[model samples]
Target: MSRRDIVTAIPTSFHADGSLDIEGSRAIFRYVAQSGNEGAFVLGTTGEFPAIDEDEFRALVAAALEDLGGRMRVIVHVGRSSAFEAVRRVEIARELGAREFAALTPYYLASAEGAVESYFEAVSEAVGDGSLFVYVYPKRSGIEVSPALLARLAKLPNVIGAKISEMSLDDIAAYRSVVDDDFVLYTGADRDLVAAGEVGAQGVVSGVSSVLPKPFRALAAAADSGDSETIASAQAAVDDVVRIIGGDMPRMKAALRSMGVADGRSRMALVEPDDEALAEIDRVIAAYR
Candidate 1:
């Protein structure tokens, strides 16, 4: 596997009453920077972007850039259900000096290939000189960003890369085949980091890394060095951590709280982990620590 960058898809911080916790979010960004990961992908799926309003979104973006902009790269996710709204987000981040941005395909209503292409065309234009990453999460967006579509989008000068989610290694390889060698690809699958690298993905935008970064960092190192023993160990650790968290917003926040990072509440309606599950999550964190 080639050297792979690990960018954490950090969660948003919210108080129990479902309000944005700007300070807590700043602390979370600070923690990601201190953890030695390559960068932070903020206001992403893990951050619960859909639930956050415009004001809350702006505050989160400002807080993340303020905290991590100088220390590391910060990819702001400006994906929204409408092209106009997505462009507005791009403008907001650009004003804050954000250079890299990712936007998912328009969600909720089904979008045809033409509409999707137009949407990205508008967003790429808005990004102008800044870098734009096409975020393809078909499961949530209900839109498939086919390799063919991506090939066309790649023609846009600033449409530099993509962060692919819920797709197979073969699917990613297909994506790689259609684009130029310099076109970057980052897998959203935390467990397949090494395999994705093998298939030409340059990195992973990992939600799991937001909480347990050590194992992911260790895995990246092991892959780079071809250390089979360490790779196996790190991969096992990552799988276990993902299983414990299970992509639950509440559970991830709970794990963050266990690490003394931030509050364990979500604006989205989600069930808090039971005591037994929470105990297991703590054990998982401690083992990695």
Candidate 2:
């Protein structure tokens, strides 16, 4: 069986007034590592990267590397609307000894044809010899990365792999068909780890795994061993986690708070769960325990 990686898309902790919570962030890093995840995909969608300012971004990168640098692989997301800014983040992470980086296609603007390739080219150049993964999330990036585009980017020496988020297994299979055998693929859809693996994806960059990782780890294990019963059971647990979080950062933070991992505050305009929702979240967490 092939190796399977479960890298958690962790959240950036913030105080009530929206200050960076360094210790809280470190605690999350420790929690994920202790839970047996292979890596941490820091400062991605789940980390609220778009809302984070320059200094906050640096602090998060430093904190993550400090906490988990040697213990596990830390794939820092340095994606920005500006390739220059993304390059700057990549330089910062490199200065701090980060070896793995991921960059999203430039967003919030209508780029001409080939702009996405150019953006990745700039970031990959900045990365030098370090590994870089193309982050393809069309729903948020306002751009679609076709498999052909990925094929072109894959030619870049440092462009080693990609994280395909909010996409279908068919999409993954399409991507798998384009890239070479060594080029890695990871799905952002948390519930489809086993299926994605079956389709040639080596891993997952799962947001749901940040708050609840055991099921994800179990699912990866089952995938590795090709254990049908365990895969079904672990997938069910992951589904329950997805249902509880409902793909909302506020609820994810709420679950983390209940788990005593991090506080439930966000810089984004996300609404926290109210009475009924909070009660359900708590009940579900209790049942999981």
Candidate 3:
């Protein structure tokens, strides 16, 4: 894989009782590796980050590192609204042998550009060593991290780059324009994978790809090969998968279950797929297959 490539935001597999499934960590990693892409972003929104507790959080990252430690680059998301929690999570991941890390813009309180920058600055300072990827998700974070802020933060020795989850091509381009050509700007939205790549996005951090990594993996190949047609077709296929799976992770787990991978379960109170949704998920598997 090129440095500019795809890395999935893998789902945190859980058992029926809503506990962290350690074995499932290796299971998910094997699936991603077989899909032809290396690297992953664990415990992001797709992994139900805020929903899972600290102990559960630590166990999952430990499991991912133990499973994919030497084989693939694992960048774990260690950001919550609380700066203290983010610091604690980073410390734990680093200790577990997690090599790279990423963080969402802080939530539940102030999310202004400066406030969010301050939150990441503190996180980088907390780590005080390794580089970190700042996750830019305005919808959940409740604030947009502007390109200017990203550029400023990227100047920090520990702030390597960012994972821009938003979908503005101009915004992504703006980020690329400021940072070094090699600066990592990972795309979070799968629909814009090709376009974002065109704008110099270095890699992808996708949620939908977790259920089925093959298509996104292929899309990444097309992007790397500069095959526009294949990229478009793969994007269309992923959009179809997204349409079937929707944003509901329980439904994504359902689709993964159909593929004989994940166990098709989620945390407490997460809505399961309705009959129509299940049927659509089945359609996605069969069509994609």
Best by TM-score: 1
Whole-model lDDT per candidate: 0.90, 0.86, 0.78
Task: Give candidate 3's whole-model lDDT.
Answer: 0.78
Q: What TM-score does model 3 achieve against the real structure?
A: 0.90
Candidate ranking under TM-score, highest first, comes to 1, 2, 3
Tens-digit per-residue lDDT, 1-289, candidate 2 = 7758888899888898988888888888888777678889999999999998888888888889888877789999999998999999999989888889999889989775498888998999999989999999889888899889999999997999999988899999999999998999999988887788889899888887787777777777776667788778878887887887755888878888988987748888888889888887787777563
Please write out the lDDT profile of model 1 over residues 48-131, one tens digit for every residue.
Answer: 999988888888888898899888899999999999999999999898889899999999999999999999999999998999
Kindly give the number of clashing pairs for every candidate.
0, 0, 0
Kindly state the number of residue pairs that clash in model 1. 0
Considering summed lDDT, which 10 consecutive residues are worst modelled in model 1? 242-251
Error of 3 at 107 (Å): 0.4
C-alpha RMSD of each candidate structure in angstroms: 1.1, 1.4, 2.2
State TM-scores per candidate: 0.97, 0.96, 0.90
Residue 11 displacement in candidate 3 (angstroms): 0.7
lDDT for residue 193 in candidate 3, whole number 0-100: 69
